[model samples]
Target: MAEDRRKEIVRHLSEDDLDRLLAETDDDKISKRLTFVKRLYKGATLEDAADDVGRSSGTATRWARRWNEGGLGLLTPNFGGGRPPKLDEDEQDELIERLRDGQPWKSQEVQHLLSEKFDAEYHPHYLGTFLRDLGLSYAKPRPKRPHQPENPDEILEERVDDALDEDDQPHNKRAGDDGEGWVVDEDVCTDGGTVIGFFDASQPQPYDNSRRVWYVDDPHVERPLVKTEDSAVGFYAPNGESLVTFTEDETKERICEVLELIREQNPGKRILLVLDKHGSHIYEYTRKRAHQLGIDLIFLPSGSPHLNPIEKVWDYLKWTMCPIIVENEGEFKILVKDVFERITRRISYAQSWCEKFLDLQKLS
Candidate 1:
């Protein structure tokens, strides 16, 4: 640090440049730079100039160095600007047009698209600045996908209340306790009676039922798809015991059949069916038929599949069983039947799933 080597602005701005600096209304950064120079020209120290222009001493020093090296010309917006953009004006216009055509693009995805299509590569950090300059801001992610039910936390809380009241359970109960029993109405029967059951519709596809799979790190290993002539819709509990029925189409009539089957299975008492509010389940014809038989339907809260214990069963079936039973449609049906029997026989599995929701009532 030599005392005699103090840096200063060596050239004065022309009258026109001074006028433009004062009159210019855009580009705050450029305005700050001009103000720093103007303050320094008024015999202010670098520190004083920085304070007057609301910039740091380092910024003032850089502005002085640029002005000293290239006179007033260096103060222009383009002077010593970093690298030129990869996308030209025309290319940028095309990119904006493509983006406006209604598709969401993550920054990395956009980077890849530009690299592959336009042969333009950008540092990930610069991409943020580029997007901000283009007048784009980060958007909050959607809460649910299309056709998904819109429910508030209070709605789920209400369902828990209703479920607890229906079962006549006390408000306080431990979550992991074995006391969560599917008790039938005592007045209905003494030795045997109709049972509570969860029900949902599922389709077993040949491909991986989930987005993920157990595989070696190989991008080229394509996922296999079983191109069946028709799809099969299964009506049963998600993770519990139910009288499952298969149909080519999941219709109001098919759901009514399921209800009748449930009623027939438990002949002595009225069957209590816990199911989602699917259109088929709530149709006029389906409800009337259910009422005629000794079948009671309890619809779960909208958009709250988590509240349904049987959701776990569908997850187990698709991710665990569907992957292996891929020989043909016949084999798939056989696999479903085998798994269904095993699930129904092992009552503890379904009970454990049911217990979770039972304890949800006790949750604060």
Candidate 2:
């Protein structure tokens, strides 16, 4: 009933009063509103009334409310626009430039800078939205150590290509080719089919384990704090055949042994091993052993671990094993080997590396 009464002819003003105001009004603004009230009194809706006066329904409602509350005086004009921005447009652009000066900024620090420079203040919660509005995002920056061989991809690709290439003609066995007269097809460049292997060694300490856990009432996920580390030297292939050796320590002798082991496993295929320039693998004896075994070695550029897919394999292995419980270093080593075997069962790990750096169609 009250809504019906208010809708009839607007409130407080009667039909006669509106006619009187419309006749005597000299103000264009007040006269426009008087015409709107007359439309409502003659059966037009709030929407139709707004359309008659070239105003929105919401604006008509505000005008009607103001007219009911304090008559004409209250609806004249709202001079107070809104809370002014702490910083003007030019000042905002300057603040954005200052924020992007390559230095990470904290909320409190930004607040201080604003107060110090522009004499402006913002609450910390609102500042996040302000920074985002200014085209900035929050993130933790990681430190990246610089490395050598500026063109690492080109350098590495060239080496791997050389290793995988099969020479058109065979050359005589070199005088010092391990004193065993190198297998002509077995040399770094060979006519035999090439078997590419990405190799890396990871030392997961006894204290290494998953940092996060889903638990009820707090489960104490723990690992033994031991002084010794376990070394895992791994060779992964795209065809899903992988080899991982667990050792107390990685040494040149162990590397040569692993090479012999791989040769024994792979038989007559021309082996091309892609590995980092580690001391053990690059030692003269190790190179001689590789040549003797007819396995070609391609070294990745220094400090460029991202180029090798084997590092991801190691990370996956550690992550897979990190959740399980193990008591001592002996137990940890066993668990590590078991987890590695399971992870290597799937060949998906090497697919990305091969697609980026290898021509699998040229294996023969």
Candidate 3:
């Protein structure tokens, strides 16, 4: 009876059935089973067929036995037991649509939202894969401001004179035991400058930065919609000391106020301030006031924020604090101040900026 059943099974699958099975099945194991059975019906020995398809002879024999008992019905997947999906198809479709409503969502925020809305729980790493499967991707969000400077190269070239020698090595400075009386490149400051710092201002926005966000790319993408707060001027000193204050405007008055703060902090000390050429910075009154306060304002060439090591501090601050998502100006100021304090408390950060110039050998 078993011999007759095996013969019947062999006759049941035609060449067309074999081709269709191989073409339609995507599962690797199922495709291997079909190939094994088809080869057996094509005058191949059980061992030969198993060897051709890289299957064990025992696996081939077991599958053949099942086929003889139930024909093709036994070959179909059983489709049983595993963890169910956290979201149904409809819910998944809705979640994708909700994400499209605008603004990128952080991975943690999205994970929390999933738990609240659909009672779904996922490991943070797995959540990234799940998001990609749903046709979402990670992207960096940048601020879209008008008339960004295009002369960073020129600015860098200008500063290179102050940093490099004729042979392009660092222009080193000699210092006393107290690390004072060092001259960098020349004309950097008087014989004994008190403090060295980078000065700049930035207007942070409500928009997020320095974090991965879930976003769908459209061919015709526009800048992200974001709200900005009032600007702040800052002076970052070599010892990681920073003077940051909120300003309603970037006028000469505000510039003078910040300089006064710098003067108060370094009482009776000369400051070598590396800054850019904003109209307020170049204003006759601002320059005179800076000179009177014993602050030598060294202007950076056009469009050169990269030369300012303190710019890195601004980048770090935005990435660390902006993603927290403050609603009002009050919260924004408080959070920014707190984060700034935490960052500047480390003296190592200040030394790192100062080392860039100090490491160079003195120009002979």
Candidate 4:
């Protein structure tokens, strides 16, 4: 019965496909086993199937065992074809050295090299897989840099405490002084395009001053000219009614004017003037004037433009008075003057803005 089953399986095979399978000598036994298994599935007895396929009873039993265990797949042959690698240990080392020396051996380059040097035709993709199997990969070359000092973990807390202590100390300390002195704040406007207006937090009523207290008082208040290439019209306000243009010479004059006003107002009081670090404000003439008037001038650190209160006032003016257009210089002057009048009336708002700015600086 098994021999009959095996013959039936062989009869079902396509002649052309069977002939192709027979062409691979190594796969013949596996193909014969597949024919036996097919016959067994069709209900032939094991012994008859074995005889019909010219196999011994033991061979038929083995094929039956494989079919019962794994079905038709057990009778199929695996075809893994390719030549063994030609590049051995020494060749691998040479390839790595060439790559390390900055020679480009990309898959295409390697393929070209193989054809030229070893007379082997290789696909670029195949060569790439070969290189990958050898633990090689395409990567960017990185340059090395000098080592830096390592952070000392144990001293981190102590270093941080020292920094905090240094920051807490007063910036300027007098000899043998234990108490921290006060820091006065002052703002200097350097751009002079037009006279807008000014707000003095130090004065409750800046408009009530006999002399013009802001940019609005300047004779050239109406002309909307650019003070400097970097500035727009009315960029800096020096006095309550004066828009002083930004110039080394003009800055010196404004500083002198502020010093004069401080001197005139507080005849006996020693004043500390805090100003932005503009070159003209720190010039010899300005310094001498401050010294002569018994004014101590302290400047804000460089690049800290927002530290100056005048900048805040300028921002307010720009927001409230921008888009202010005039047909003539006189008309422009009148508009600017009106803006100052409005600012003078809004002293409370000015004070609120100034206080908020100072609070922000403290937090920063």
TM-scores of all candidate predictions against the true structure: 0.45, 0.64, 0.43, 0.29
Regions of model 2 farther than 4 Å from truth: 1-80, 112-119, 148-151, 166-192, 205-210, 214-228, 327-331
Candidates 3 and 4, the one with greater TM-score: 3
Identify the leading candidate in terms of lDDT.
Answer: 2
Query: lDDT per prediction?
Result: 0.60, 0.70, 0.66, 0.46
In candidate 2, what are the lDDT values of residues 212-318, reduced to their tens digit? 66788967744445434557778876652577777667799988888877776676667788888889987767776777687778888988888888888788776
Full candidate order by TM-score, most accurate first:
2, 1, 3, 4
Off by over 4 Å in 3: 1-193, 209-228, 347-353, 356-364
As for TM-score, the candidate ahead, 1 or 2, is 2
Judge candidate 3 at residue 87 and give its lDDT.
88
RMSD of each: 15.1, 15.0, 18.5, 25.3
In terms of lDDT, which candidate is stronger, 1 or 4? 1
Listed per model in order, the count of residue pairs whose N, CA or C atoms clash below 3 Å is 3, 0, 5, 26
TM-score of 2: 0.64
Worst ten in a row by lDDT for model 4: 199-208
List where candidate 4 sits over 4 angstroms from the true fold: 1-254, 261-270, 330-364
Q: Residue by residue across 1-364, what tens digits does model 3's lDDT show?
A: 1221222245568878888989997877678778878877877766677778775544455566667766677754453457667885457766776777754899888988788888888898799888875657799976533443566545544454354323322122212222333223232332343566788899766566445666677433255544545787878876425678888889998899998888777664456677888999877667766765656666676655667776777888887775576667787777777776676655334464344444334311
Show the lowest summed lDDT stretch of 10 residues, model 1: 182-191
Worst 10-residue lDDT window for candidate 2 reads: 168-177
State how far residue 325 of model 1 sits from its true place (Å): 5.4
lDDT of 3: 0.66
